[model samples]
Target: MDKEQVKKLRAICRDISVLYVEDDISISAQLEKLLRKIFNNVEVEKNGLSGVQSYTKNRQDIVITDISMPVMDGIEMCKRIKLINSEQNILVTSAHNDAEYLVKLIDIGVDKFITKPIDMGSFLSNISKIAISIYREKRETVLESRIKAQQNLQKELLNGIIFPLAYFDEGEIVYANSSFKKQFFTEIDAGDFSRFRLGYLFENKKYVSMSNSELVQEISNSDDKTYLVMDVNKKIVKKYSISVTKFQNAKGCLLSFVNLNALNEEINRFSEQVDYFPKRESFSQALLEPKKSTKENYEIFCVGLKNTKGFIDKYGGAKMHSIFNSLAKSLKKEFSAEVQSKELSIYLFETNRYIFLVEKNLDNSAIDKRLSDFGKKYNYAFGSGLPLELSFIKENIKNTQSIGDILENTEGMLYTLSTI
Candidate 1:
C-alpha cells in the first residue's frame, strides 16, 4: 500500500486494542514494540493458553497468534475463541506453509494471515485493513442498537396511549404505533413494510385514498388539517377526529387521531394544542383567479431540494427546518428590499418544495441572475456550512392569462442550481 493509505490506516488503528501471542521472546518483543506504537492497548501472551485467558478477560478488538505454541496451538486457541464469540476477529502468523493447515485455520474462521519472516510493511498493511473492517462493523452494531432502543421507546409510549397514531418524516411514513399497525397492516405485512400502502387499510371502500405525498400535500394546503377517515369494520360508520400536530422540534408532524364519539373535551383539547398548520390558499387562489382591476401577471419559480434524505441524515430534522425557513426568509428579503417593480408571494407546497410568484415584467434572465445571487449568498449564511441545493424551474405567465398555460408550454421541469 501507498504511504498515505498506510498513514490513514495507522490513524484508524488508534481505536483498536490488540492481543498478540508468541512463544519466541525475540519475535514477541520486536512485534509488540511496533504494535504498541499504533494500537491503543496491546496485550502480549507467551503461549496460546495465556492468550486464551487474556482474551477471556479483555475480548480485544484483534487477536494475533503464532501457529505453533507450547501448551496449545493457534488453531486450537482460535476454535475456543470462536466458541466464546462467533464474530471475533483473529489473525494468525504461521511459519508452516502447508495448504491443509491453512484450510484448518480458515475453517476455524480466522480472518487474516501473515506468513513467517514477516515483511514489516506488508504486515502493517494487512493489520490496517482488518482494523478498518472491525471498526466499521462495531460502529454499525452500535448504530443498530441505538435505532432499536429508540423504536422500543416509541413502541412503549404508543402502546400505553388509547389513540391510534402514525407519524411521518418529510411527507413519508417512518413509523406507526402498535395500535395503528395492528389495525392497518396484515399478518403478511407485519415485519416487512416495503409494500406498505395506506389504501390497504380499507381495500373495498374508498373515501379519499391518497399516497403518503398526496396526504402530506393536502395537510399543508388546507386550513383544516384533519382527515376524517371512516372505520368500515363497524356496522355503524365510525368517524375519526384527526389532527396533524404542530410539533416544531421534529421535521415532520405528529398525526393525532381520536374517534368522534369520544368526549367533546378530549377532541377540542387535541385541536387546540396541535392545530398550527396554516392554510396556504392564497397561491392556489392566485393560480386560478386573476385580480380584475390591476390585471397583473406573475413569473412562477417552482423550487425543490435535491437528495433531502442525505441532508437530513447529516444535519438532522431541526436543521432541515432551519434550512427551509432560512431560504424562505432570504427570498422574502430579496423580493421586498432589492428587486424593484416586482412583488413576491411564496407558498411552502411540501416539506422540500416551494412555489414562488414574482411580477412577470422581469424576464427569465433577470430571475436567473437574482436566484443565482441569492443561492450564492445563502450558501455562506451560517458558519456550519450547509450544502443546500435549490432546484428551480422557470415558467413565466407574461402574456398567458393563466398559470395552466405556462405549465402546458414549459419545456423543462426542474433545474438543480446549488450542489454539495
Candidate 2:
C-alpha cells in the first residue's frame, strides 16, 4: 500500500484490535511487523486451533485467517470461533478463489474475501472497510447491551418478594407489578391503567387525593432510598421503603415499594413478649455473685423505661412492645449479662415503670438516640439514669415514693445502671 493509504488504514487499525491466524510461521512473523504498523495490538496464531484459543482469550475485534491449517482447518476453526464470539469481525484469506470455499466463509459472517500471493494494497484497502464496519457493529452491540441491562433491572425490581411496587408519571399510576395488583386485588381496565390513584382499590375514600407526584419527585432527587409509613383506614401501614428513579428518554418516574408491615408485626410481638414478662425484681433475690473471667466483664448496667403508658397507647400495644423488644435485644447484643433489670422491692411503684441496668462504656448518645426512636414511635418521651453497680442499682429501685411518682416523675425510660 502507498504511504497515504497505509496511514489511513493504520488510523483505522489503531481504533481497532485484531487477530491473525496463519499456519506459515515465516509469513505470520513478517506480517506481524506490517500489522503492528497499522494496528496498535495484533495477535498472531500459528494454527487454526491456537487462533481460536487466542480469539476466545483476548476478545479480538478483527479476525483474519488462511483457508487451510493443521490440527484444525480454517472452516472448523471459524465455526468454533463464531460459537465463541458470534459478532467477530472475520476476513478469510485463501489462494483458491473458488466459489465453494468463498461462499462458505460468507455464510459464516466473514467480512471480506481476499486471494493470497498477498497483494498488500488490496489487503490494506479491504481492512479499512472492515474496520469501519466493525466500528458500526460495535456501536450497535453497546446500544443493545444497555437496553438489555435496563430490561433485566426492571424485571428484577418487579420480582421482589417483600416489596409491593408502583411507578408513577405525574400523580397517576403509570405501572404496577404483580405484587401490587395482588395486594389490592386491582382489576385494571385499559383506561384505568393510564391515570389511576391508589384509592381505586380500597373501599374507603381516604387516600384518594394523596398526591404521588411529590413522592416520585423525592425519589428522583435523592440517590439513596427513602422510607415512610402512611395511615390507611386508621391502620398504620408500616414502613414503606421507597426508591424513585427517573428515566432520561421520557419525563417519567419509577417508584419502588417495600411492605414493612410484616416486619412491624414481628417487632410488636417481640415488644409484647418483653413487656409482659414477670418483673425483674422477682429475679433480684436470686442474684448470683459475679464470677471473675478473662473473656468478659461480670458487671451489669440497667436501663429503665418510665411513664411509657402514653407511648403504648399512641403506638399501639403491639408496636410499642416490639420497640421495647428491639431495644432489649440491642442492649443484650452490645452488653450481654453485664445488664439486668429489677422491679423495685418497695410496693410504691407505678404501672409500666422498671429499671434497666447496663454494664458497658457504650456511647450514651447512641443509646439515647435508639431509645428516642422508640419514644417517637409511641409519641412519648423517655428518660435515662446514670450507670451504677448492680448492687447499688437494685437497692435504689426500692426507694421510689409511690407508684405514681415512679411512673410520672422519672427522667426517662432509659436510665444508666452505672450512675443510678
Candidate 3:
C-alpha cells in the first residue's frame, strides 16, 4: 500500500482493540509491534488457549490468530469465541493452504483470512475494511436505541393524562385522545379518521351553518365559548363546551372538549360561593376548561367478551352483571388505581359487547401479556369455562382524528375478533 493508504488504514484502526495469537516468538513480536502502532490496545497470546482466556477477560474489537498452535488451535479458539458473541469479528492467518482447514475456518464464522508470511498491503487493507464495517454497525446500533427510547418516552407522557381532546387542521380532524375515542369514536375504525371532516361532527346548526372559511375566520378572530353538539349514534345529542386556539407555527387549530354538565356543575358551585371567594373570575375561568394539547401518548385496549348472550341466558341478567363487575375489579387490581384510577372504565354496549377503556402508560407488548394472563384467570367467572378473548389497539393520542372515528374503528376490531 502507498504511504497515504497506510496512513488512512492507521486512522481507521486507531481506536480498535486487537487480540493476536501466535506460537512463534519471533513472528509474534514482529506482528505485535506493527499492531501496537495502529491499534489502541494490542493483546498478544502465545497459544490458542491463552488467547481464549485473554478474550474472555476483556473482549477485543478484532481477533487475529494463527492456525497452528499448542493446547488449542486457532479454529477451536475462534469457535469458543463465536459461542460467546456470534458477531465477534475474527481474521485468521494460516501457513497451510489446505481446503479442509479453510472450509473449517469459514464454517466457524471467520471474517477474513491472511496467508502465511502475510503481505503487508493485503493485511492492512483487510483490517481497515473490517474496522470501517464495525464502525458503521456501532453507529446504527446507537441510532436505533435512541429512536426506541424517544418512542418510549412519548408513550409514557401520553399514559399519564385522562381527557377527551382532538386537534383540527384545514377543516380536518388530526388527533384525538383516549377519552375522546371511548366517548365518541367507539365504533369507527382508526384508519378511517383521516377521511373524517370536522364540519360533519357538529350537530348544532349555528356552528355548522357557516362555510369552512367563514367558520375559521370567526374562530380566529375571537376566543369565545363555543359548544360542540354531536349526535352520538343518531340517538343522543351530547353537548360539550369546546374551546379553540391556534396551534403555534401551524395553520390548524386545536379543539378541546369539556363536558357541558361538568362545566355547569362547576359554574353553579362557584356562583353559590361567590360571596366567600375573592378571586371569583379567575377561579370560574379555570373551572372545567379545556387544556392545551400536550400531545400525550397512550395505548387503547379494547376488551371484548365472547358468547355474552348465551352466558347471560344461562346465568341470568343478575349473574352476568355480577360476573362483569368481578372482571372489572380484577382488571383494576392488575392495572392499579394509581396509574388509571377513574380512567379505567368498563362500558357495556349493545347486548353482548363489553369494552374496557384503560388509560395507562404501558407498551402494547406489556399490556397484551397482562391481558392474556388476565383472560386465563377471568374466564371461570361465567361459571362454565366461558370463552373470553381480548384484542387491543394502540393510539398515539397526539395523532388521533375524531372521537367518533376512533369509536367506529374500535368497534369494528372487536367485531372481527368476536367472529374469529
- Winning model by lDDT: 1
TM-score of each: 0.48, 0.45, 0.47
Deviation in Å, model 3, residue 246 alpha carbon: 12
lDDT tens digits, residues 1-420, model 1? 676875777787877899999998988889999898778799999888999999999999999999999999899999999999989888889899999889998998885899988888888878877898988987899999999999898789887787778777765567777766655555555666655555434323442477765665555566864444544334243455566775767787766667666556455544532232222465556556445115565566777665566767876765666665656556656766433443555665555556666765546577778777777666622445555666677665665454555444432333232231
Error at 215, model 1, angstroms: 9.4
State each model's C-alpha RMSD to the native: 19.3, 14.4, 21.2
TM-score of model 1 (CA atoms): 0.48
Candidate closer to the true structure by TM-score (higher is better), 1 or 2: 1
Residue lDDT tens for model 3, 88-149: 99999889899999889888888589998988778877888888997778778889999999
Better of 1 and 3 by lDDT: 1
Candidate 2: segments with Cα more than 4 A from true spot:
1-17, 38-40, 56-59, 70-72, 83-86, 107-111, 136-165, 168-174, 177-199, 202-322, 325-420
lDDT of 2 by residue, 1-420 (tens): 678877776765676898899988777787777788888988888788898888878988888989899988888888888888787778887888788887777788775777877777778778888887877777799899999999878867676644566667667776677665555433443347655455433233443454556545544565655344443334444465566667788677766666566667777765655554345444343233241112332222234454344555555565555445554444344433233332111110123233443233444444445445534443222322221111112222223234343333233322332233
Report lDDT (Cα) of residue 247, candidate 1: 71
Stronger candidate by TM-score (1 vs 3):
1
